[model samples]
Target: MSHDDLERAGFKDRTRVAEALETVLGAVSGHDRTDRVALGRADGRTLAETVTAPSPVPGYDRAAMDGYAVQAADTFGASDRSPAVLRESDDGAVTPDAAVRVHTGSDLPDGADAVVMIEETETVGDEIEVFDAVAEGENVGDVGEDVAEGTELYDPGHRLRPSDLGLLKSVGVDRVEVYDPPTVGVIPTGEELVQRDPAPGEVIETNGLTVSRLADRWGAVPTYRNVVDDDPNAIRAAIQRDLAKDVVVTTGGSSVGERDHTPEVVDDLGEVLVHGVALKPGHPVALGVVEGTPVIMLPGYPVACIVNAVQFLRPVLKRAGNAPVPDLPTVEAALSRKISSEPGTRTFARVRLREADDGRIAEPTRASGSGVLSSVALADGWVVVPEGREGYDAGDTVAVENWEWSA
Candidate 1:
């Protein structure tokens, strides 16, 4: 479209939450790589291929208790009043008239179809008196009972959990092919931004580190580049350098102000697919592609940066890295106070969640301004106020997105 069309489309063309995510992710998918990692280090990594069991768990039919292994028929008539005395065998074998002593997990002796608990038997010299009868297969763990051999244990795209790694080890698997996480480059842009020890008028550059960590949590390898001045040429050079990585993220220069040059810089090098999202606190967000790599531009405010990261960048990395999209925990919370927001924009209201006598309560942090960094740090999570609605009333039950870190 031409500049006039773009201008006419302005903020009123805010992309919905789902559409923005779909658009960003749709453009960044199909970029994952695969690598073989040791089973010990495979936790939290997505499987690149299916894994089948090499061997059945408990490869042998073993005793499930410390008892005597005997033929089920041999103990049928045995009771406390009429005990059946049987000869004991030293070797792991049981005859029709004899029983074999076996401990828990010991392979069931040949000719034994059941185990009689030792507590039910009284030991006499060279013989065991049985008082209870055990049926065939009772208390016996059969071969392949836990996990069958040659079974498809884990499928491609399965994210390994701690127990998943344990299961792999149990199935005799030592190595697995996992999707290599995408490499994300974060560039913080602003002339007034300083890396450390900001003066009174200067702002500290924290978005790069914050976004880098968030990307890392999304299962991507993040590289935080140094702060770049707001100059269009400087931002352009930074973007060009960061294109070496799988995805590039720029913070602070996404707005339409004169100093906000990320959109122009990205457009000069490649194409800006999305210049503005319809989400509040993150409306200035931008999604673009440079040399076939995704480049996401975030708003300068800490809260907006975080919200856009979760709304846009998270999904992109999830697809590009082949990681399963995280379903953030949510809670039904009663709004402690009323929240006011403009119509036509989806708003993310920072909230501090508290458990009260009535129930879980969501107290608004009132940190809608993009520059309100403390609001995000103090919030437990946020509530999404959908577009076309003025706001939510007090005492309204809303779904609050819970932060996994806080939990």
Candidate 2:
């Protein structure tokens, strides 16, 4: 909670920050796999091991078009004024001076020059039909041209898309070994925190549900518990309930408020890797361990909670699942209006994107506060404002990270 803490932690150094992150996660032994699930159900699951293709893509030589396959040199001298004749047999057999009737996927016969397209040449019943000259080999797709056999179809950490699934099915793969998704125990801790189904003065348990949705997005099974009072023992026991799971996320009690017991509870139960992070909206983020399972303590503010969850905690769970980090999609856009922020911590604000005369512009939403949840809900993408800058203004180019781009 002091500048001295920042000095000791060296939060300004990216290498040190990354080192802190790995040290926190390295202590955790990720959850292991058990039963095998069907390919259709393996959408979010990470691949425990590599999945190889049993067969090659485009296993056969297939025609590229409805046009003709011809020996390039055969139609060399034929053109509009000087027409060439293509001989056609009663059986539609093709020869150097002849043509054959072939479908798109039909195999090429041995020692046949080419099947000149009807448009390329004018066929007068049984002539070596030609209107244009041809090269040596044209309109022919060779065997294994699309994909080579025994090549690495997908790797260990590759996430499967619909196209990837189709590729797997095309290559004769029935099943794959995928990492078992870890379970996350989310506890919303605050005396003021109330349940959706509640007593007097109780508000809906929105944070827990939000965390649950995030867990789903990050490919983890979330076991959400009811709102509990700010009691250290109660919180500790609640966390212990999901010992079988991988990571635990607890909201509230991250700051030095009177009832804040998260720090004490974490210290009593396990090691506290970091009591605070040097970031806005989530400066009180507590990275620690409880009984060896990693715990990520987040601030109670709606947008703050959401931002920290994505930029920090999600990566640990993603690695546990053996899934490659989803690319954080960024698009260069200009600011529609001016915006300001303080130095010392990075900030992410949600904004809408629109095409302007010059290029795309990011319009920052006015609803930016710890309590304003609609700001993020209405956001098309997030604008990142780094520490130590005065602010960004209209026409300033910046990278806006989108929620779903490739998806």
Candidate 3:
């Protein structure tokens, strides 16, 4: 936690929040491999190419009910009072004076076009009496009724759900070409950072776990690594080792402190597209490319780390997975108290929401500290104060992004 004189010199050129995000998003594209996966394992995987039905469903004309298939004209005038009298054909053919018995899903007789329910007919000796009539196509399932041949089942980049998998299976698709989830390496760096068990004054390393889980939720395979010390050589070596991954996320060491070596290491290895942003809690966020992999250096503070993950790492992961970037749900809520932000910095104020008679109410969880991770856990969503807006007064309606999502 020691600071050097050189660490006081901050970024000379800072990028606008929106521009920085855009630059990072534009630079990092998905690096997915297309491979065939069994239908059982295709759920949640994105389609690498469009899928088309090879053949029609119910491939043939068949019966749709458990009734006798008969020529439409044979039962035309059949009614309750005077039913049609017809004999069962010995050869199972629908002759002028004979009817054919069929069951549901059985193929209709060559000369039959409809089916008459058994309840509508009664047997008398060797002849049957018909009471009701059916149309030419009634009780019949036509070819391609469910799905036609050459129909597009799904487009490229479509994420398959369980229902989609059932549909694919129904259409005889046993395997599919899907874009494999990208592999991400999450590295946490800090000399005093420790794993789950921490000593006094040692910050337990949690960003790696949090960010890795977030990446996994976004359809990326995450590999969490041990914490690296604040030395430039150690940080650079870790980045080099993880360069084989599609994306590398280093938590902490992004600021200008002497202990912050991630930005310098990333810059020494490759181009640093963005070093600083006009954003609260995550101003020191850095976006760069190491070798061919996208490297994101998140702020050391847990709250800022999580905020950066949502605002920045999410899009990169989505693009890398070849999945659609879903729009986060937002709702307008009345502020319970005044919320303030710097003049030129975009602020993401965590708030706890409550339901009231008027509507939803948003109250800031904390006014001063961004490093308190518990405040983030207590918050239900965030009130995003855009850049250029100084603050909002109490009772003002503002848009808030909810954290929970229901399928």
Candidate 4:
């Protein structure tokens, strides 16, 4: 009995465990630091201020159709059988429709009531004609029709997307105020873990790289630490090494096993807010505060690490950065096999997605144990199995999580 014992001591099911963790987080006040940053470097950053239209999207009256800008009265009696065209006002505004030529997106001439599309007009002698009646303002996109002046373009805390950046450019927002992201320190524990290059029989340490990649994806900087052993003193020293960071994330020692020393170190240095959660394969997820900075202890399991990152830690990161919490990418797919879960805890099962004849099929990945990192790499994503449910049935519609492809 260790962290699991603590987890079971407090939670009857995974739902209770998650609910309590959220409750604690809800009670914690957020710390935010907002500053203006150049839009070039703000690709994935969150906005701290709501953006309003400096000017209308188009800013003036423009044409939606390609044709001759003319007075609607000029074509009032025109029909499919008969068309009318006016060769007047070739220079009244931006030159009248002397040639009855207009391209898409050109501005409508002032005082002109409508446009006769070239496709609809036919040339008879030196004049062109509209075969159909032209209505006033029919082919014109009125000023601010697409987006009005003084309107909000985007709300605060919006995580900028490529399209969002393009829209902001349209609004002439070259820079925006955004909450600075909290730097999370990533420390991989265990004497056996080796960085990048490893000797024979020694597995390469990947927690730092994977966590760093995820942090980068979420618009946060992940500071990698030198590998430390599972000793409380060494871990404390490691925590102090990155105390300037806003959050500290440690891998390993979350479980209360004989080799687990992270919990002991956190206990010695700072209060461990949580020792266990009710989530399967990740029940030992821990959260605490060290030297006035938030600390997140993720289980060393890769899939489990990713799961809690989505469930428990991401919310805090979003709040602290004032970023728009992106919705988890998901889709409805049928289960390929019947899977069962223990009655008291939620399980995030590694799943492989397949394109079936009818729809997608989600099957559990091989090497789904908590210690399996290979399974996480090969998985399409994780599936949430709720506590208290027997399991999902074969062909049952269940939610399947997918990657958020944000560039």
Better of 1 and 3 by TM-score: 1
Weakest ten-residue segment in model 2 by summed lDDT: 9-18
Q: What are the lDDT scores of the predictions, listed in order?
A: 0.85, 0.70, 0.85, 0.73
Q: Quick one: ranking by lDDT, best first?
A: 1, 3, 4, 2
Query: What would the per-residue lDDT of candidate 2 be over residues 1-407, giving only the tens digit for each residue?
Result: 34345446544433223555777778766566744656787776666667766676567554454555555565678888886655664454445655555566666554444555656765565565678775554555556566677778777777777677767777777677777777888989887776656678765667788887788787878888888788888888877786567888888777666677776677778777776665555666777887778888887887778777776667777766666677688999988888776665566767888887878989998525866778887888887777767568878998889853322
Give the per-residue lDDT of model 3 (tens digit) for 62-145: 888876778878888889999988888889778786888888878777787888888899989999999997888888888888
Worst 10 residues of 3 by lDDT: 1-10
Cα lDDT for residue 194, candidate 3? 85
Pairs that collide in candidate 3 are none
List of clashing residue pairs for candidate 1: 301-370
| True-structure RMSD for candidate 4 | 3.3
Clashes of 1: 1
- Cα error of candidate 4 at position 398, Å: 2.3
TM-score pick, better of 3 and 4: 4
TM-score, candidate number 1: 0.91
lDDT, residue 6, candidate 3: 29
Each prediction's total of clashing residue pairs, residues at least 3 apart in sequence or on different chains, is 1, 19, 0, 8
Poorly placed runs, candidate 1 (over 4 Å): 1-10, 77-84, 124-126, 341-344, 388-390, 404-407
Span of ten consecutive residues with least summed lDDT in model 4: 91-100
